[model samples]
Target chain A: MKRTFPLIIAAVAGYVMVVAYFMPALQQVREDAEEWFNILAAIAMILGGASILGMHLRKVSDRRAGWGFSVVTLLGFLVTLYVGLFKVGVPPMPEYPDRAWTGEYIAQGSALWWSFEYIIYPITATMFALLAFYVASAAFRAFRAKNLEAMLLLGTAFVILLGRSYAGTLLTGWYAEEYPNLTLPGLTDMIMGVFNTAGQRAVMIGIALGIAATSLKILLGIDRSYLGSRNG
Target chain B: MKTETIILNSFLGLGVIALALWMIAWGQEGKFLGAQYVEVRDTIEVYDSRELAWFRTPDPDDPEETIGYWVERAALPDSEPPELADPEAGDVVVEPADLDRFTPARTWEIQRGVSRDRADEDGVVLSLSRTIGLWFAAICTLFVFSFLYRDNPFYKFAEALVVGVSAAYSMVVAYWTMVIPNLIGKLLPDLVQAAFVPEHDQPFYAPHIGVLILSILLLWRLSPVGGWVARWPLAFIIGTTAGFRLIAHLESDFAIQIQATILPLVVRDDGGFNFWMSVRHLVIMLGVMAGLTYFFFSIEHKGFVGKTARVGIWVLMITFGAGFAYTVMGRITLLTNRIEYLFDDWLWLIS
Candidate 1:
């Protein structure tokens, strides 16, 4: 009964939302669904933060190695939290400055803002920047010209890499103007525009199809891995 | 159930209804009511064009006022334009035509009274065929799914081909859509303008050229010669990105999120208590505390702190479950959306 009821609700709501697409009268169903999604996502964001915090806290409590790092993370987290909560350093909102709590938390000079500009921005950017090094190392490993096909892939990779840069233009700039039609930049354009676009479109099509089939299976109760092993 | 839970939920439910109503009303009005929109400065071309390098304006249907620049190609001169500008100052000219070019022209729209243009009848007719073609393609989808039955050569071949084709396509998109037009189109023109137009003789293309060199260095490091060439470029990218992110994190995480937490209990205009919002914040704040506490490795999990930290575990689990469920549902919705597009819009499946 538990499983059946939930499935029924899913089917009904799912079908309704689907039907709502064409039926102007049923548009509200789509809107309601979208609203629900937003609320749910917002809630999930909170949940994500909670989970991240929880994981680190447990590490610290367990006196795990790198617990010190966790402490730093927690301290930063709390300090940022405090600054934001009180809207520290925020000037009074022009309309409500006389009111004690009326200032914006993220006002330019606010402590929250200052911390964000000084602390959080650099750390995350630094982390993301790490991807470049990773990508470079990964490319070295992956882009080996072991065979004909690999060579072709390597050649394409080289073209794309150079094509994105001024070096490409400098090397192939002659073709851009002299042959204009046959320039390296032009070659890059063709490779990217025609060949690359076609390839991406095909994959996207496959991914879309796979997603469709997978969803149908789930909806029909064919696939239940997501819902855990039990029916209920 | 406690009446408090009911009352709180009711208040939250009302807010949801109100927000939904507002969005619908906004959409009906053809207005972007509460969404953030950013506009870039100019158009992009296959090759470089200095005059047309900036990102265009916010989409016409944006709900919120854009928070960006008002600089013009004219203001900056064809020779020199600011790399980035505010999102608000200028009218953002949206280029829907660019998006339209990617798809086969929609003749079905013409048939359905959604559009009346007859200029691309051939494209539309082709689009119609493609719609029906999707159903045929669905057959291949089954073959792809055959892996579930047993791992076979056929599935493997199909999967590899899909990956190969997708990789090829993505490489192209990254270059054409994101790279060539963005880098060359913007820089080339500026370079030309700077060289010829004496007043605007700014060194525009040199850095890009330098970056290009570094990118090559990056690639060359793979070769046996000057194996160290890769590190210089890597260092630049890493350093810049790290610096940019460091500044951004403070604003986004510390400032914005914190600001978001401190809210007015009562919304003045509606005279309604923002109970759900407050509860949401409080729960989030608690969750953050608990989660962070749980991660504190310096302490032992033997006492009151240990038990309190466990609350973080429960919060994390429930959150993950909900997120997974929502993601699954969203994927389903996207699939359903695409299916409906095929059945109804592409092929006249029913009537």
Candidate 2:
């Protein structure tokens, strides 16, 4: 009963979404279902938060390796959660001066906003920036002219990289007026527009078919891995 | 530690201290360490009366149809009220006392101009909190960059903080933006309207009650008991996602792509033959077919099919190379921005 009930729910929900596209009347029902799903998803985040807290708490309690880092994680989580949920140091909207809770959780000058601007933005941006070095190093090691395919890849990358930079313009800009297509930037555009589009379209079509088949399997109850182990 | 390592660490520490001193000195000299802004002249409009009324207006799309929405109009004694298209529908006069319960009185208008008045403040000042935020951001940025050298304590600390802070931040944003406004506001409108959104007049939606129940069931996963019940909502989510993605992908990726690829092999511009455009169209058509042929696993690649598939692979390689270059360029731009932030915002070494 435990597994069957969920399977029935999945079938109904999936069919509703599929059928709603053709029937205009069922569009509102589909939208309502989507909204309900979003609400449930948001609530599910609390489950995730609880799991993280439990794991970290266990790590700290057991005095495991890198427990100090877990402590730092807990502190960061608790402080942010408290400041944001409580709307700490956040002023009410100018229109709703009497209502304290009327203020935006991430309002300017608020603790939550401060945490996000200072901690989250910087760390996220720097993390992405660090990838530049790794990618460059990886390219240097991997890019070789030993074979035809490798040589083609390397040549294409070189053209694209040079075309995007000012140095490519400095070198090819003179010939652009006389022979536009032969220039690096012009060649880059052509390759991207023709070759890239063709490859991407083919890949997208394959993915779409895969998705359709998988969805059908799930709807038909052929795929029940999402329901987890039968023993559970 | 090696002597070289000790010397490098010493230099880094000294550099940090020196930068900190410079920042303090710069701040003391009235130089801000964050974003600069410009002031502009704003035009303000003053209205005499606060009395307002709700007037029924004709739907713009269909003149015969009238919408239920009542457009708010300030009942200015001097100016003439907008004439309603529907003469039968009289104006619903809202009392002055009830104006607060409805939309607030629109008394003033502010017109923003594009040009800035740079003569004011010279655009070099930041708020106290913003200034502190700059320093904090700089410190975090350094900590994250430290990972490039080696996996150190500083990098681990920053990584842990990000995981914790980002998760909690998203949850808080989702709660305020989605759950409270959509669910609570629709289910218990009175309480939400009274405490949070005073202008929230949306009628109670019965389906929101079901959403609330489902949300509670989903949260049940947190508890030790009845964890299996959470599968119901999870299943619903998965089903809806699959259903939505299937239709979306088929419509956009499969059908639309096929439709777009069906272009005329021959091209003409201004009633004359265009060579380049014709070549481009032919290449696109042939390339797409070749790429598809490469993906086809039903027949073994041999002879002409093998040759076409080889061309397809070359096209794919070029595509991947371009994509890689684009990504690397983007990441390099981000790295440049971080360096700019350090030099321009923190150290004040550049303008």
Candidate 3:
């Protein structure tokens, strides 16, 4: 019953959505479905929070490696949730001067606001900044010219590294002045705008066709693997 | 650690400390070892002579009462107030003072945003609080950046704090912005209306009923013996996404991409092939065919097909390498921004 019911739902939902896209009268159905999605998505976000907390709690309870970090995570999560939901440090809005706790949770000077501006923004920025260092190290480890393909990769990497920076400009600036086409930047741009775009386009076309076929399969109940084996 | 590694680490540490000290010195008097942004006065290319840069001119949308309106640095240093400043014959020399300019005219040496009143420095309310806040921010920023050296307690704490706070902030924003306003407020229209907030008149639509039933069905999965009930919601979600993605991808990723590849080999603007453009066009055409061929597993890659695939591999590598470099450049930009914030905003080191 579970298998058959979901398949029926899948077919109905899939066909309804496809039809909604094509037919003019059923346009509102798409919008309504999106609204339905939003409500479900909000609940899903809450579910995510629950899942993260649950995982961390279990880890802490188990006394696993990095369990102390898990404790920190839980403490951080709880404190933030408390401050945000309770509007701990929020002052009343100017319009409603006399009203207590009737202010935006993110009002300036509030604890949550302070935490966001000071604690959250900086850490996030720094975390993301690690990617620059990580990528550089990754390139060093990965780029070994062992074969013709590897050599080509390395050559391209060198062109890109130089061309995108002041070093490339310095090296090829004279050539650029005499012949714009011969310049490294010019070569890089041409390579990217033309060759890259073409390759990307081909890949995307293949992916799109694959998605359409998969969608068809699911709609026809030919891909019941998502639910489980039919025997189960 | 090896001596060489220790030496490098020491130098990095020294550089950071030196930079910090220089910032403190600059903040005190706006001159740290005579270092400043070499004021480059030049005209930048203008698109639409009337259009304004961000925070440059008064916003047309907002009323005059809004702050940051009258401030602009469009006028050249030598020129008298440029009314219809010709973009072709104008130079801008913007400095820190320019941004803090509150007056309609310069020669008014008054710093606008900055409170120059010496007495206010001692004022416990705004000054003390702001000072504490800036220090707190700087300390947190340092804690996060400590991860660059090695993961420690400070870094872990900072990471946890950021993750937790951001997650909560997002949830709070969603609840207030979406769920409460759309669902609860709409459903309890009269009560919400009485609370001086707008609510939809027609909330009990077919979609609403459908969503409720489905939501109930979804929640039913949470029950001990009813886990299978969740399959319906999962299937619905997957089906809808598949349908949506199919059409969206087909239109955008396939049709548009295919259409885009149909390009002219000649550079028409310069009235000829322009020498290298023809070569570029040829390379692109070949690359596309070869790349598609490489992905085509139906034919066994041998002889002619294998050669084409090899060329395609080169194209793919070039594409990936260029993409990686671009991403690296972007990440470096963000890192540069944080460094700038540390100096200019946090430490008050440089202008």
Candidate 4:
């Protein structure tokens, strides 16, 4: 039931949504189904939260090691939750001046808002920015021009990287004024416009086709490995 | 305690579920009534009715006529059963507006269009051209895919062609979206208008150009003599972007998300009761912190901190597994969708 039920639901809903696109009558039905799915996903978040808390509470009680960290985590979690949910120091909503709890939890200038603005934003950005360092390292390792094909790939990459910026234009800016056709930037632009787009479209089409074939296998009751070992 | 917890939470969970179902029903009420429709109606006072007479005299029995006709909210009827409608009928009986809903992009029409506005052009010309292009690209793909098959000249040609095409397309989009709109729109008018008013003529080069200049400086690292020139712009971008993003990321990710976890056991007047949700958040926050502690690679996790960190790893692993499972399901769904399209929409090889 676990395996078959999910597959049947997926197949039915998937097909319905697709048909809904080409039919006006089914539009609302399709949108409603999508919204319901989202709401269910949201509710699942509560379950996830409970599971996390339960697991940690067990570990802290057992004192397996580094129990201090669990204490800190639990404390931090509770404090943040309390601050946010209680709307700590958040002024009442202007519409409900008499009500103490009418204000939005993340109201501007509120403590929760301050915490978000100051504490959370920087950490995520720093993590994202770390990708640059990773990219640099990866490029150094992966971008070896061992063959003619590799050489061509390398050349194209260089042209695109340069063309995207002022460097390509500066080197060939004189060409823009003198002979626009022959300019490095213009040539680079043409290569990207004509070549890269065509290639991307083709790959996308193949991937789409492959995805279709894969999906058909699943829907037709042929490939059901995703459900794990036991069908029931 | 466990039984009591389950009993107490069961009712709460049921309440939440009921609320969710009601919200969904309310949101999609229009669909249920079969009254949600998009229709475009315009009365054209044609100088000669013969010019567009075909639309006016469209066959009443034709399904296409009803396609665009909207069923008004007040007049909406119950959905006729599929069995009554004869689901076995292969033909699509959609209301007309659905067919004309999606308009292809201007550039796409231009690029893929047959012979740039030929009056006597065959309808299949664009399709044929696309087919030919696809075949050539597919062959090139096979060659590119041949890298897996053991690299050869055919693959090389495809790879090079792909690179060339990609570069060209990016330039086209950049020109339309960024260069012409941002640069020319700002510079040309002000320059022309400046002839009359010198103060108004001040050319405002967008800060984007400055950023672009800095980006160019990054390329200087490739050359020996002028590589030093790249550092100034690099430093500016790094410093400014870091300064700008530092606070924004922290607020949204850490503070607000963490704040969201707190549960209020008692609802102060007018604060809608969210006791369960707050507790849930607190738990999630604990999980996140534990997970982070697990990744503290620099510190040895031997004693108190170490064991707790280990628990954190388990949390992370479970989270990862869940995320992976979710993604797999999504991919499967996408795959299913495409197959349905092929079978039902484009190719009617299968029922």
Between candidates 3 and 4, the one scoring higher on lDDT is 3
Give per-residue lDDT, candidate 2, residue A8: 91
Score each candidate by Cα lDDT.
0.44, 0.79, 0.67, 0.43
lDDT of 1 by residue, B148-246 (tens): 446555454444333322332233323333333334434575643332221233344443454455445545634656544444443333323222233
- Model number with the top DockQ: 2
Q: List chain A TM-scores, every candidate, in order.
A: 0.84, 0.96, 0.83, 0.78
Distance from true location, Cα of A172 in model 1, Å: 2.6
lDDT of 1 by residue, A1-232 (tens): 3244434434444455545655899776565444333322232333344454677689999999766656655665555555554555555333221233344345443455545433333233333333444455565786677755455555665665565557778887765656764655665665554334333332333344445555445445464443333422
Best by lDDT: 2
- Model 2 error, position B25 (Å): 4.8
Q: Is candidate 2 or candidate 3 better by lDDT?
A: 2
TM-score on alpha carbons, each prediction: 0.38, 0.85, 0.73, 0.37
**Of candidates 3 and 1, the better by lDDT:** 3
For candidate 3, give fnat to 2 decimals. Answer: 0.56
DockQ of each: 0.01, 0.50, 0.33, 0.01
B101-145 in candidate 4: lDDT tens per residue? 333121101122322224134432223323333233323333433
Q: Considering summed lDDT, which 10 consecutive residues are worst modelled in model 3 chain A?
A: A92-101
Q: Is candidate 1 or candidate 4 better by TM-score?
A: 1
Please tell me which model should have the higher lDDT, number 2 or number 4. 2
Per-residue alpha-carbon lDDT of candidate 3 for residues A40-128, written as tens digits (9 for 90 to 100): 66655665677678888999999998788888778877787788767776654333322334566676556677678767777788778
Tell me the deviation in Å of residue A48 in model 3.
0.8
Over 4 Å off in model 1, which ranges?
Answer: A98-105, A229-232, B1-351
